[model samples]
Target: MNKKLKNLVKESYNNGQLDQETVVYIAARLSRKDLKHYISLLKQEEAKHEVLVTSAEKLSSEDVGKIQKLYPGMNVIHSVDKSMINGVRIVENNKEYEINLNRTFHDIIGFLSTHD
Candidate 1:
């Protein structure tokens, strides 16, 4: 029964209309503890992180290749954001790695402020 419920939830989620109200109603009808457990499993499945590489300009294939080699199995998405100034930023899951001129300038300003 729990397996069937999980499949139903997953199906609804995939179909793109699984709203909070629907989930709340479903949980109200089901055992709260079991529903929570199933939801945790579903979240874990959804937690497959995608790597996003943002830079000031479009990245070359070699740059993307290096990121792929670094992350191995994760999906990589690249986009150009001119605000980065120069260099790249990598975001995976909730963590961000900024290696750019803009970031360096900010760091320097922060250091100067602290020292003053």
Candidate 2:
């Protein structure tokens, strides 16, 4: 994607500052292949701004709110994973933060094995 077009696309989608007329004007200038590449780039950019929070069970609205507060300006998505066995696993900016029974045990086992 062209840097200028990429920036305009991000700005238009993220802030909704660009009007419909402006979007139509921009789209009119791009070729079919360029448009497809732009759409793919847009999807990748969208994913970067999302926060995926998965836990062993559904989180309460209050809990979700707390997580949302932590990641201001970014979209927060919650999911359930019973294998986590409780606690949360937050994935943001391509990094994983896991705090759960499974992680705890793994840590303990690794520690004991290394110390022996």
Q: Write the per-residue lDDT of candidate 2 for residues 1-116, one digit (tens) a residue.
A: 58876876766562633356666766788899887776676667777789999999899899999998999988998889998898899999779988899789889999999997
* lDDT agreement with native, every candidate: 0.78, 0.81
lDDT of 1 by residue, 1-116 (tens): 76777675675463443467666766777687878876875565454447888999998899899999998877799999897799988888778888998879999999999996
| TM accuracy, model 2 | 0.69
Q: What's the true lDDT of residue 109 in model 1?
A: 97
Segments in model 2 whose C-alpha atoms lie over 4 Å from true places: 1-5, 14-36
- Compare the candidates by TM-score and give the number of the best one: 2
C-alpha RMSD (angstroms) for model 2: 3.1
